[model samples]
Target: MRAVAIAAAAAAAKARRISGRLHATSSVRQYSIMISPHLKNITLTHSDSSIYSDDRSRPYGQPLAVPWSANQIRFAKARGSDVRPGNVIERKGKVYQVVKAQHSTQGRGGAIIQVELRDVDSGNKVNERFRTDEIVEKVFVEAKSFTYLYTDEESDSVVLMEPNTFVQLDVPKHLFGDSLAYLKDDITVSVELFNDRAMSASVPKRVTCTVVEAQVPMKGMGATPHTKKVLLDNGITVQVPPHVITGDKLLIDTTDNSYISRA
Candidate 1:
């Protein structure tokens, strides 16, 4: 009878130990569930794919999967020698528009490429030097036809509308900078779109503008083809030939804002 009592006490202690282990497991699982959402948020905040990975110590285990429907930019890998002026490129995770690219070969060195870049969104300028064989990421943008609407004074943006769908979009003034002086209503302009966002706008290579005001040629100025400063209807000032006068229509090069000829 005593042996049976001892066996019963031992079985009761074993059952208690099993129950404790199951309770601990349940508590651990609940704790993990509670913390999982916070961990996910932290991962997303630090795991943006656009960030450049330069540190070797930090391990990015695997790339996050991107949806197939997401917009993807077209890019090509090319050497620094192949980059051209007016091309867009990605460098150190920043996008820059190439203003000018020059290649030179020195007597002692193999070759070098110099590039002047402007930050697409910040309007900052930077000069970069690269070896001829250095690789670069060249981005391609698509040009779409858009008609000039009116400038939004409140937002300080130029409004443009698509012809086919009449979809209106407001482009930041800084995107075109001084080039906006050439924009005119009802004129068709080319807007460079990247990832469905307007990156820049190009005015017609040649535009006709009426002379709103002109300074008369000075009498004493020698006959060395003296030029006079004239203001166009768009408020841009340019030097025109002495023959140009008020109300005269003149052909101007929008690229350089220079006088071309009498229209």
Candidate 2:
């Protein structure tokens, strides 16, 4: 999210903590491909399985390191118009994850795709505009399941663990933003990775949270269905129907922190 850009800058500074080791694998077949012919000198190659090449002498270019231990990595392509949040794309010799994408029309000029991108390496953010139909290198990554351990406020990172191996990872706390309140101890979280980079973290859309406080409704508080602001168990405030009250467990949309239904 655009709001998480501030947190991304701080998270990318630390060398991530890891618990498991992955061994290198044998060589695989590789080929060269480019969407545009103007930049044919770039020698980045994509193998059926591996994305990087061991050799760097070729005129084409050095490929990215292959994730040998994990078989969930995937490769794909998308136009700038189709780009959305969390899509990892490479541009100008750097890889970035899309944080926000907006489309606008400029009278007779054409459609412009405006995007906010966060660097995969440094978490630095940049705004760029692209023409519609421009081919973009999109890498579809798979998520690794981890158990929510705790939020390490001192380090500004959230700690997670592998359910099977118990290996722990400390991710940037800002990555979760306000949604951090929905996290509970030992909950399953999906972390997406690209070339060992933590692209994003997400929780289930709906989470059961108890209303900690709310005012009783009187007359028509709202022109339509009356609503009231209530505090949640995790210290997040949300607007809910007057029927909701203290001690009521209601489903909340973690994506936007909105009230869903009584749980």
Candidate 3:
């Protein structure tokens, strides 16, 4: 009887991991204490409800956040290692993707290397941060260019056209957030696609736009100058200096939508 129960428990654990439905739960511990010899190397399978006895209490579909710290990641030395997609390895207790590797450098750094990385669970790309001597694992991230189409009045959504293709994808307005302010008709945006759908999009790091409105200059604002709210042509409002007036062109940083300088 005990052996049978242990076998069942081991089977449950394997099932939970595979389904990705099993979250950390104490009820899972009821069967976790048992280990069956045959189930030692068993692979997890989806639809295994026996994995977590606490399923009734815990939320379903919550992803486990794996943390990877900066100190733990060391650069991989070889460009052609087994850094393939969907391989999870631990570096400094944090996990990162082996997105893509390329060799190139501007005139200054000689032929240095670059590796794009993505946080596996959060699905965010960490900026290129490894040195040329460092070898890192690869996680596949799909990239494609899409042309801005138009937004829907009812759904408050926008559309993008895939390059070289007639297919259009409907993207929610909230996903673009402030970035949408700068988008013009037919503007091209770099999109990161995962599992055949768009996950993230980015625009140029810097862009210049004409200010639609600026507040009046303040009295005795001091030599440093006081900044006030200014609306741009795209309808996004940013803080600008007191001297800034309507129809003034200014360069802005797209990274945070902060004002840089007059265009």
Candidate 4:
């Protein structure tokens, strides 16, 4: 019975020690939480801090995400005719892909060019507007020649193969809709790859197509033109001029999918 009592006492002592250690850890956590406000103010900007607070009107801060700055973006070449979509940009030593570009007036403000960029690694897209003359980074892309092999029957995806090589890749048809519009047999496209797979594609500046079917012109149509839509051979339909008819070739601006004029 004496030995049993001694064993019980020893176990109780160990438990007390563990309890003391846990209390010490909790006290440290509380201390850190008390000092966190000052640390946050030092580390985060005013806009960033506002995003973190419990204010419903402010933007929410993404936790544990790396911050990217638009000012750090560097342009490789001068802003000219070459500033087009699918161009990779290097900013703060990281790469981003340009998805779309639009220039518009900001309601009584000067013209601003809004750019949509997709993170090359995460495939996340963000929008930012800048002046038309603003310089941006243009990162070098490594693309190789490849050819379309066939479409997947089960998954509804198009399979591609490298020319003179047996390597093959399968991509969704929806993701390649724009490519399929002008993609011809054995045509070449600049494919941007991430982790050994094609993540995005870049096409030519402009392409010309013959209007298979054009609607009769709706003369004196109101503010909104009487838009009669016609389907193209690529399985895409777009509204065109009423004067256009079947077999009339037309040049289209592929960027905006807008009709230019009769070819």
Candidate 5:
């Protein structure tokens, strides 16, 4: 009987030890499950940091380059004949847009390229001659939509705003030159921006303006290509057909400043 009691006691002690071991294992598993979500959150935070690290240093929502400027190409000046109209070139730290390019070879000199260029910032026209071996830096500019707000009489500048964001900017009047005659309140124009500054503004190809003053047409002049001088509401003078009269709204081509038709 004594041996059986001792055997029973040993069996009971073994059972208690086994139960304690199982309880410890279950506690460890519960701890692991509880910590898994925190670990996952930490990993996600690291991933987000890596993804947006570059963006944090740039302007908000601003791209590295203009979207429409992707096709812009740069050409090194190798020959005078290589320069073409509509090319923008940089010289003496000033930018100029080429309006016309003509290559000519003098009787005694090397080939010379004559280029008529318009100053990008001042809208002034200049004539330049370049040698075939001279180096020129070609630049490309991109245009954006801007709304005409008003002309600042004090500064002789035009005020414009972005169409979508309404960001306002003031551009020099000379940048528009005679094109300013076509500008009206609330008119939208294509503005070329360079270095975050307005370089040029282009009016629509055609615009309607009221004829504020028109001279009486000469009857005998009908046999010839005769046009009467008329003053527009914008104070610009243009030639119009004989039939047009005062208060007549006429369509005008902004490119050549020629009359198109009656509007």
Candidate 6:
């Protein structure tokens, strides 16, 4: 509770200053990304030269080499070229996880780093572009394991607890998207944190799902591999092979809800 209050106060106090300092570059953009049903608006701009990257410290566009661990935080300033998907950054005093990043070169405008960022607290998202040479405040976050607790519908967050210490965190639910359906009690989730705050979370790449109700395939559709929609215990309906029947277990790709194979 104390930490939440401090973070909110800090964000509110500095929000105006960050906005005042950043003029929407003719290139800056605002985006409303829906990683979940709760995402909201976004805005961004570049900081002044004072906070630009220290070129001599590292080569341009080199990715961070940190490994995953618990309760550790590392911070650095790097050029936009060095940013990548899954990296956490602070904009307007709020932290965001980079969902996607792409490098593009214009015939004359030099290199641009296009990024999609998701707010760690609100699940809101934004898209912004940066000069390859522009300095960005990068929060080096690493994934730590936590046990899936349950969703707090009122708060729109998922509760998770550290395995050893039992410390709990409320991660924004939107980070999970449709994959949230795969969550089961005591399941392990990978959460990326900076300063003990969750910036992103993911479930296992594969999950076991039960075939509850499989629709019969029509004989007219032939040649192609036969598939039919089957409901899972978690209430998700996905296509499975014709042979799959009620009570059968199947491995599902959590990333895209695709059927893998019989489990």
Best by lDDT: 6
RMSD of each: 18.3, 15.5, 17.5, 21.8, 19.5, 19.5
The candidate, 2 or 5, that scores higher on TM-score is: 5
Error of 3 at 203 (Å): 2.4
| Model 1 RMSD vs true structure | 18.3
TM-score of candidate 2 on Cα atoms, chains taken together: 0.65
Q: Estimate each model's TM-score.
A: 0.67, 0.65, 0.44, 0.43, 0.66, 0.67
- The true-structure Cα RMSD of candidate 5 reads 19.5
- Tens digit of lDDT per residue, candidate 6, span 1-263? 99868855655555455445443333432321112122122222232322223332433233222123432437688889998988888777888888899999999999899999988777878999989999888888768999998999999889999999999988888988778899999999998877777777899999888888877666887675667789999999888887888999999999789999999
> How displaced is residue 233 in candidate 4, in Å?
1.6
Tell me how far the alpha carbon of residue 136 in candidate 6 is from the true structure, in angstroms, after superposition: 1.1
Report, for every candidate in turn, its global Cα lDDT versus the true structure.
0.75, 0.72, 0.61, 0.57, 0.72, 0.75
Distance from true position, residue 43, model 2, in Å?
Answer: 29
Q: Write the per-residue lDDT of candidate 3 for residues 1-263, one digit (tens) a residue.
A: 99878867766766455445555333433322223353333332223343444444334433223233222323333443344433333345555545575666668765654556565445566545445655544333467788988888697777889879778887656545467787777778776655565545666677888988777765776675567899899888888877788999999988788999999
Off by more than 4 A, model 1:
1-73, 217-225
Worst 10 residues of 3 by lDDT: 62-71
Go through the candidates in order and give the clash count of each.
Answer: 0, 2, 13, 4, 0, 0
lDDT of 5 by residue, 1-263 (tens): 99868855755564444334432312222111111232221111111221223344433223222122343454345455778876677888888878899989998898899999888767789999998777788765668989999999999899999989989989888878688988899888887776677767778888999999999755775474567799999988998887888999999998888899999
Instruction: Return whichever of 3 and 4 wins on lDDT.
Output: 3
Error of 5 at 34 (Å): 38
Deviating ranges (above 4 Å) for candidate 2 = 1-77, 120-124, 218-225
Q: In candidate 4, what are the lDDT values of residues 34-99, reduced to their tens digit?
A: 113222221222223232233434342323222233223334654523456777776556666778
Tens digits of lDDT, candidate 1, 1-263? 99868855755564444334432312222111011232221111122222323333433333222333353447889899898887888899988888889998888988999899988778788999989899999888878999999899898888999999999988877777678888887988888877887766778899999999987766786775668789999999999888888999999999889999999
